[model samples]
Target: MQLNPEKDTELSQKVNRETARLPWSELMRHFASGNVVWIADELDLVDVAVRIAHDDKASVGQWMAAGQIAKVSDAQARDWLETDTSLWACVVSPFILVQQQKIRH
Candidate 1:
Protein backbone atom coordinates (compact mmCIF):
# COMPACT_ATOMS: atom_id res chain seq x y z
CA MET A 1 0.00 0.00 0.00
CA GLN A 2 1.20 3.47 -0.89
CA LEU A 3 1.01 6.39 1.46
CA ASN A 4 -1.24 9.26 0.53
CA PRO A 5 0.83 12.39 1.00
CA GLU A 6 -2.19 14.63 1.46
CA LYS A 7 -3.83 12.36 3.97
CA ASP A 8 -0.63 11.93 5.91
CA THR A 9 -0.16 15.65 6.08
CA GLU A 10 -3.73 16.20 7.12
CA LEU A 11 -3.48 13.52 9.77
CA SER A 12 -0.34 15.04 11.19
CA GLN A 13 -1.95 18.44 11.24
CA LYS A 14 -4.89 17.04 13.13
CA VAL A 15 -2.61 15.43 15.66
CA ASN A 16 -0.80 18.69 16.15
CA ARG A 17 -4.04 20.53 16.63
CA GLU A 18 -5.12 18.09 19.33
CA THR A 19 -1.83 18.15 21.19
CA ALA A 20 -1.25 21.89 21.19
CA ARG A 21 -4.50 22.48 23.01
CA LEU A 22 -3.47 20.60 26.16
CA PRO A 23 -2.67 22.99 29.02
CA TRP A 24 0.55 22.72 31.03
CA SER A 25 -1.04 22.33 34.45
CA GLU A 26 -3.27 19.49 33.35
CA LEU A 27 -0.28 17.89 31.75
CA MET A 28 1.50 17.89 35.13
CA ARG A 29 -1.61 16.50 36.79
CA HIS A 30 -1.61 13.63 34.36
CA PHE A 31 2.03 13.10 35.16
CA ALA A 32 1.23 12.92 38.87
CA SER A 33 -1.58 10.37 38.59
CA GLY A 34 -1.08 7.19 40.62
CA ASN A 35 -1.08 4.94 37.60
CA VAL A 36 2.49 4.30 36.52
CA VAL A 37 1.32 3.99 32.95
CA TRP A 38 -0.31 7.41 33.06
CA ILE A 39 2.82 8.92 34.52
CA ALA A 40 4.98 7.27 31.90
CA ASP A 41 2.80 8.53 29.09
CA GLU A 42 2.67 12.02 30.51
CA LEU A 43 6.41 12.03 30.90
CA ASP A 44 6.70 11.56 27.17
CA LEU A 45 4.08 14.22 26.61
CA VAL A 46 5.91 16.67 28.85
CA ASP A 47 9.15 15.96 27.06
CA VAL A 48 7.58 16.97 23.80
CA ALA A 49 5.85 19.97 25.33
CA VAL A 50 9.04 21.18 26.98
CA ARG A 51 10.75 20.99 23.62
CA ILE A 52 7.93 22.88 21.90
CA ALA A 53 7.42 25.42 24.65
CA HIS A 54 11.18 26.04 24.70
CA ASP A 55 11.15 28.61 27.52
CA ASP A 56 7.42 29.16 27.61
CA LYS A 57 4.96 27.19 29.74
CA ALA A 58 2.36 25.21 27.87
CA SER A 59 -0.81 23.55 29.23
CA VAL A 60 -2.06 19.99 28.82
CA GLY A 61 -5.52 21.01 27.65
CA GLN A 62 -3.97 23.30 25.07
CA TRP A 63 -1.82 20.52 23.71
CA MET A 64 -4.80 18.16 23.68
CA ALA A 65 -7.01 20.56 21.78
CA ALA A 66 -4.28 21.61 19.40
CA GLY A 67 -3.84 17.99 18.32
CA GLN A 68 -0.11 18.38 18.07
CA ILE A 69 0.57 15.40 20.32
CA ALA A 70 -0.82 11.92 20.64
CA LYS A 71 -1.74 10.74 24.12
CA VAL A 72 -0.03 7.57 25.23
CA SER A 73 -1.98 4.45 26.21
CA ASP A 74 -1.25 1.50 28.49
CA ALA A 75 0.05 -0.61 25.61
CA GLN A 76 2.36 2.16 24.52
CA ALA A 77 3.44 2.53 28.14
CA ARG A 78 4.37 -1.14 28.20
CA ASP A 79 6.38 -0.76 25.03
CA TRP A 80 8.22 2.16 26.52
CA LEU A 81 8.95 0.18 29.66
CA GLU A 82 10.09 -2.87 27.73
CA THR A 83 12.44 -0.81 25.62
CA ASP A 84 14.09 0.55 28.77
CA THR A 85 13.86 -1.68 31.78
CA SER A 86 16.04 0.69 33.75
CA LEU A 87 13.44 3.37 33.17
CA TRP A 88 10.85 1.26 34.92
CA ALA A 89 13.20 0.50 37.79
CA CYS A 90 14.33 4.07 38.25
CA VAL A 91 11.24 6.02 37.31
CA VAL A 92 7.75 4.49 37.27
CA SER A 93 8.26 1.72 39.81
CA PRO A 94 10.48 3.54 42.28
CA PHE A 95 8.39 6.62 42.72
CA ILE A 96 5.60 4.59 44.21
CA LEU A 97 8.03 2.64 46.32
CA VAL A 98 9.63 5.78 47.65
CA GLN A 99 6.27 7.35 48.44
CA GLN A 100 5.15 4.23 50.19
CA GLN A 101 8.30 4.14 52.26
CA LYS A 102 7.71 7.67 53.34
CA ILE A 103 4.15 6.92 54.27
CA ARG A 104 5.13 3.85 56.25
CA HIS A 105 7.41 5.97 58.42
Candidate 2:
Protein backbone atom coordinates (compact mmCIF):
# COMPACT_ATOMS: atom_id res chain seq x y z
CA MET A 1 0.00 0.00 0.00
CA GLN A 2 1.34 3.42 -0.90
CA LEU A 3 1.53 5.92 1.93
CA ASN A 4 0.45 9.45 1.23
CA PRO A 5 2.67 11.95 3.06
CA GLU A 6 0.01 14.62 3.06
CA LYS A 7 -2.52 12.22 4.54
CA ASP A 8 -0.04 11.10 7.16
CA THR A 9 0.67 14.71 8.16
CA GLU A 10 -3.02 15.44 8.45
CA LEU A 11 -3.50 12.34 10.56
CA SER A 12 -0.59 13.40 12.79
CA GLN A 13 -2.19 16.78 13.30
CA LYS A 14 -5.51 15.16 14.12
CA VAL A 15 -3.89 12.83 16.60
CA ASN A 16 -2.03 15.73 18.18
CA ARG A 17 -5.22 17.71 18.54
CA GLU A 18 -6.93 14.76 20.14
CA THR A 19 -4.16 14.06 22.61
CA ALA A 20 -4.74 15.08 26.21
CA ARG A 21 -3.46 14.76 29.70
CA LEU A 22 -5.68 12.26 31.47
CA PRO A 23 -5.65 10.97 34.99
CA TRP A 24 -4.62 7.40 35.41
CA SER A 25 -7.78 6.67 37.37
CA GLU A 26 -9.90 7.72 34.42
CA LEU A 27 -8.00 5.30 32.19
CA MET A 28 -8.23 2.33 34.55
CA ARG A 29 -11.08 0.74 32.65
CA HIS A 30 -9.20 0.86 29.36
CA PHE A 31 -6.16 -0.57 31.08
CA ALA A 32 -8.30 -3.29 32.56
CA SER A 33 -9.46 -4.14 29.06
CA GLY A 34 -5.78 -4.47 28.06
CA ASN A 35 -5.98 -1.63 25.60
CA VAL A 36 -3.43 0.75 27.09
CA VAL A 37 0.09 1.01 25.76
CA TRP A 38 2.76 2.78 27.83
CA ILE A 39 5.09 4.91 25.79
CA ALA A 40 8.49 5.94 27.14
CA ASP A 41 9.17 9.56 27.94
CA GLU A 42 11.93 9.61 25.37
CA LEU A 43 9.50 9.27 22.49
CA ASP A 44 6.94 11.66 21.07
CA LEU A 45 3.45 10.47 22.04
CA VAL A 46 1.85 11.94 18.92
CA ASP A 47 4.47 10.38 16.66
CA VAL A 48 3.88 7.01 18.24
CA ALA A 49 0.13 7.33 17.79
CA VAL A 50 0.58 8.32 14.15
CA ARG A 51 2.83 5.35 13.52
CA ILE A 52 0.36 3.02 15.15
CA ALA A 53 -2.47 4.52 13.18
CA HIS A 54 -0.52 3.94 9.97
CA ASP A 55 0.28 0.33 10.96
CA ASP A 56 3.98 1.00 10.58
CA LYS A 57 4.95 -2.29 12.12
CA ALA A 58 8.68 -1.86 11.56
CA SER A 59 8.86 1.39 13.54
CA VAL A 60 6.57 0.06 16.25
CA GLY A 61 8.51 -3.17 16.53
CA GLN A 62 11.80 -1.31 16.80
CA TRP A 63 10.43 0.94 19.50
CA MET A 64 9.05 -2.10 21.37
CA ALA A 65 12.38 -3.91 21.05
CA ALA A 66 14.20 -0.87 22.41
CA GLY A 67 11.88 -0.77 25.44
CA GLN A 68 10.37 2.49 24.25
CA ILE A 69 6.84 1.09 24.27
CA ALA A 70 4.92 -1.75 25.85
CA LYS A 71 1.57 -2.85 27.21
CA VAL A 72 1.01 -1.15 30.57
CA SER A 73 2.09 -3.66 33.18
CA ASP A 74 0.46 -4.46 36.51
CA ALA A 75 3.33 -2.96 38.47
CA GLN A 76 3.33 0.26 36.46
CA ALA A 77 -0.43 0.52 36.77
CA ARG A 78 -0.21 0.12 40.51
CA ASP A 79 2.42 2.84 40.70
CA TRP A 80 0.38 5.24 38.59
CA LEU A 81 -2.74 4.54 40.62
CA GLU A 82 -0.92 5.09 43.86
CA THR A 83 0.55 8.38 42.68
CA ASP A 84 -2.54 9.69 40.96
CA THR A 85 -0.45 10.16 37.85
CA SER A 86 -1.70 12.13 34.88
CA LEU A 87 -0.34 11.01 31.52
CA TRP A 88 -0.31 12.45 28.03
CA ALA A 89 -2.50 10.13 26.00
CA CYS A 90 -3.61 9.67 22.39
CA VAL A 91 -5.97 7.02 21.13
CA VAL A 92 -5.04 4.86 18.16
CA SER A 93 -8.17 2.77 17.75
CA PRO A 94 -7.89 -0.36 19.91
CA PHE A 95 -5.12 1.19 21.97
CA ILE A 96 -4.59 4.31 24.00
CA LEU A 97 -0.93 5.24 23.87
CA VAL A 98 0.35 7.09 26.96
CA GLN A 99 3.54 8.78 28.03
CA GLN A 100 4.62 10.07 31.40
CA GLN A 101 4.30 13.84 31.50
CA LYS A 102 7.70 15.39 30.99
CA ILE A 103 9.12 17.31 33.90
CA ARG A 104 9.93 20.92 33.18
CA HIS A 105 12.63 21.14 35.79
Candidate 3:
Protein backbone atom coordinates (compact mmCIF):
# COMPACT_ATOMS: atom_id res chain seq x y z
CA MET A 1 0.00 0.00 0.00
CA GLN A 2 1.23 3.46 -0.86
CA LEU A 3 1.54 6.04 1.94
CA ASN A 4 0.73 9.70 1.68
CA PRO A 5 3.62 11.78 3.04
CA GLU A 6 1.48 14.88 3.41
CA LYS A 7 -1.21 13.10 5.37
CA ASP A 8 1.37 11.33 7.50
CA THR A 9 3.07 14.63 8.26
CA GLU A 10 -0.21 16.20 9.25
CA LEU A 11 -1.05 13.32 11.55
CA SER A 12 2.36 13.47 13.19
CA GLN A 13 2.01 17.19 13.78
CA LYS A 14 -1.44 16.68 15.26
CA VAL A 15 -0.26 14.02 17.66
CA ASN A 16 2.73 16.13 18.65
CA ARG A 17 0.45 18.99 19.46
CA GLU A 18 -1.76 16.79 21.58
CA THR A 19 1.14 15.40 23.60
CA ALA A 20 1.58 16.92 27.03
CA ARG A 21 3.47 16.63 30.29
CA LEU A 22 1.28 15.10 32.96
CA PRO A 23 1.81 13.83 36.46
CA TRP A 24 1.44 10.14 37.09
CA SER A 25 -1.26 10.87 39.66
CA GLU A 26 -3.47 12.32 36.97
CA LEU A 27 -3.16 9.09 34.98
CA MET A 28 -3.90 6.65 37.81
CA ARG A 29 -7.40 5.89 36.62
CA HIS A 30 -6.21 5.02 33.14
CA PHE A 31 -3.42 2.90 34.57
CA ALA A 32 -5.88 1.06 36.75
CA SER A 33 -7.93 0.37 33.64
CA GLY A 34 -4.86 -0.94 31.81
CA ASN A 35 -5.05 1.71 29.11
CA VAL A 36 -1.60 3.17 29.58
CA VAL A 37 1.45 2.03 27.65
CA TRP A 38 4.92 2.81 28.87
CA ILE A 39 7.26 4.16 26.23
CA ALA A 40 11.02 3.87 26.55
CA ASP A 41 12.79 7.13 27.13
CA GLU A 42 14.92 6.49 24.07
CA LEU A 43 11.81 6.59 21.90
CA ASP A 44 9.80 9.59 20.84
CA LEU A 45 6.40 9.44 22.60
CA VAL A 46 4.63 11.32 19.82
CA ASP A 47 6.10 9.10 17.14
CA VAL A 48 4.94 6.01 18.98
CA ALA A 49 1.45 7.46 19.32
CA VAL A 50 1.34 8.30 15.61
CA ARG A 51 2.46 4.81 14.64
CA ILE A 52 -0.24 3.30 16.81
CA ALA A 53 -2.80 5.68 15.35
CA HIS A 54 -1.71 4.68 11.85
CA ASP A 55 -1.94 0.97 12.79
CA ASP A 56 1.67 0.26 11.86
CA LYS A 57 1.61 -3.29 13.11
CA ALA A 58 5.15 -4.20 12.15
CA SER A 59 6.74 -1.30 14.00
CA VAL A 60 4.46 -1.70 17.01
CA GLY A 61 5.21 -5.42 17.15
CA GLN A 62 8.95 -4.79 17.02
CA TRP A 63 8.76 -2.28 19.86
CA MET A 64 6.69 -4.66 21.94
CA ALA A 65 9.11 -7.51 21.30
CA ALA A 66 12.04 -5.30 22.27
CA GLY A 67 10.24 -4.28 25.51
CA GLN A 68 10.50 -0.67 24.43
CA ILE A 69 6.77 -0.31 24.85
CA ALA A 70 4.23 -2.19 26.93
CA LYS A 71 1.30 -1.74 29.28
CA VAL A 72 2.17 -0.04 32.53
CA SER A 73 2.94 -2.62 35.19
CA ASP A 74 1.81 -2.55 38.81
CA ALA A 75 5.38 -2.15 40.02
CA GLN A 76 5.98 0.73 37.65
CA ALA A 77 2.78 2.41 38.70
CA ARG A 78 3.78 2.17 42.34
CA ASP A 79 7.20 3.63 41.62
CA TRP A 80 5.73 6.47 39.66
CA LEU A 81 3.35 7.19 42.47
CA GLU A 82 6.16 7.23 44.97
CA THR A 83 8.28 9.54 42.87
CA ASP A 84 5.40 11.55 41.49
CA THR A 85 6.87 11.13 38.05
CA SER A 86 5.90 13.49 35.28
CA LEU A 87 5.51 11.91 31.87
CA TRP A 88 5.02 12.94 28.30
CA ALA A 89 1.73 11.43 27.21
CA CYS A 90 -0.30 11.19 24.02
CA VAL A 91 -3.55 9.36 23.56
CA VAL A 92 -4.18 7.08 20.61
CA SER A 93 -7.62 5.86 21.53
CA PRO A 94 -7.82 2.73 23.71
CA PHE A 95 -4.31 3.58 24.99
CA ILE A 96 -2.39 6.46 26.41
CA LEU A 97 1.30 6.22 25.42
CA VAL A 98 3.70 7.71 27.94
CA GLN A 99 7.43 8.27 28.45
CA GLN A 100 9.64 9.92 31.00
CA GLN A 101 9.92 13.59 30.32
CA LYS A 102 13.37 14.39 28.94
CA ILE A 103 15.35 16.62 31.25
CA ARG A 104 16.33 19.79 29.48
CA HIS A 105 19.71 21.31 30.14
- Give each model a TM-score: 0.25, 0.92, 0.92
lDDT winner: 2
Cα lDDT tens digits for candidate 2, 1-105 = 467999988997898888899999999999999999999887888878878888989999999999999999999999999999999888999999989963221
Candidate 1 regions with alpha-carbon error over 4 angstroms: 21-23, 33-105
lDDT of each: 0.34, 0.89, 0.87
Error of 2 at 9 (Å): 1.2
* Candidate 1 similarity to native, TM-score: 0.25
Q: In candidate 3, which residue ranges exceed 4 Å CA deviation?
A: 102-105
lDDT of 3 by residue, 14-100 (tens): 988888899999999999999999989877777787788888899899999999989999999999999999988888999988899
Q: Give the TM-score (vs. native) of candidate 3.
A: 0.92
lDDT of 1 by residue, 1-105 (tens): 344667655644443443322222233334456433222233343233233333223444454456533444456445544554222211222221111011100
